[model samples]
Target: MKIKTGRRVASALGGAALALGITLGTAGTANAWTADWETVDDGHGVGIYNGPSSTSGKHGFHDLYTPDEVYLICWIRGEDIANQGNVWYRTSEVYYYRIGSYNLWGNYYVYGAYVDNYYAFHHRLDECKS
Candidate 1:
């Protein structure tokens, strides 16, 4: 009986240890930037905007993505622009370009509409995975 009790205690301790380890491991990853990373939808193009609004200028990067482009969406802001209530996603990728004589590369915003539109889609980096 003593031996059986000892084995049961050891098994319980092992199970507890495993649960704690899994909880800690997942907690660490929960804080990772990849947790905020989202993929762009297939066949849709998003644009990196100069600002959260659709009226904001488009940076010169102009690289349209086909699909599954991973981007870190730091936050979202609500703005009334482009005749629709827009949810803009702020990202980490920098948009590079030159304005006449000056060169610049910086992070930009993209409108959600661009991500949903069928044609003329500009993959800016705002659309989140569905």
Candidate 2:
């Protein structure tokens, strides 16, 4: 199929825009988060981080990102797909806890952690009065 000149231009522009968006989205400060811990045995264990310590300072001093209404959040970080563990696989239960003197600041983050067998964890329902 022959695309018109205008259509071709628009298509090219759209593709370019999409590519730019993808690049910008992934681009960020290096070491944005602290590698508090990483799996020693192949990616089976897991990697723990206090907060993003990138040059951008994305996570600031918080331990994790609180849900929109103070609820569930992805408070854990893994190296790659191999390390991205879920609430299964007979692994340690990652629980984010408060650390440092930033107690009253909110969003304690994933710290003061250890290891425990976890089956699953999903609390979509929050204490919202909706």
Candidate 3:
């Protein structure tokens, strides 16, 4: 009878240890947020600016992307600018800056306008359904 009681206690302790191990293994893992992309409107090439507005300095390297070009939309913000209230989409692509006369590529902001009169961006909610 004592042997059976000892075996049951050992088994319970082993199960508890296994559960604790599993919890600790997954504790450090995190889920990062991913974004979608949008294309430029027809006949209107979008400029990947250095900041959120047109007045906020331009990146001097790449030319304007054509209407066929697509860009990743990471986030959206609304602010009053360019004599009107505008909503801007923060793109995933980084813009470069010029230091005096040299161009340096680093992490920079590129915002695209989401005007109601133009189809500047598009996304399918069905794609996120899994």
List lDDT for all candidates, in order: 0.41, 0.24, 0.36
lDDT of 1 by residue, 34-127 (tens): 2233435546466666667656777644533443232333335556565655566554342121222221224455555444441112333224
lDDT of 3 by residue, 50-107 (tens): 5556776665465333322322333344344554435454432321212222222222
Candidate 3, pairs of clashing residues:
none
The deviation in Å at residue 16 for candidate 1 is 32
Angstrom error of the Cα, residue 36, model 2: value is: 22
Clashing residue pairs in candidate 1 are 45-122, 45-123, 46-122, 46-123, 46-124, 47-124, 48-124, 49-109
Q: Give the TM-score of candidate 3.
A: 0.40
What RMSD does each model have against the real structure? 17.4, 18.5, 19.6
Output the TM-score of candidate 1. 0.42
- Tell me which residue pairs clash in candidate 2: 31-53, 31-54, 32-52, 32-53, 32-54, 33-52, 33-53, 63-109, 64-109
Better of 1 and 2 by lDDT: 1
lDDT winner: 1
Model 2 has an lDDT value of 0.24
Cα lDDT over the full model 1: 0.41
Model 1 deviation from the true structure expressed as Cα RMSD, one decimal place: 17.4
For residue 103, give model 2's deviation from the true position in Å: 3.3
Question: Residue 108 CA error for candidate 2 (Å)?
Answer: 9.4
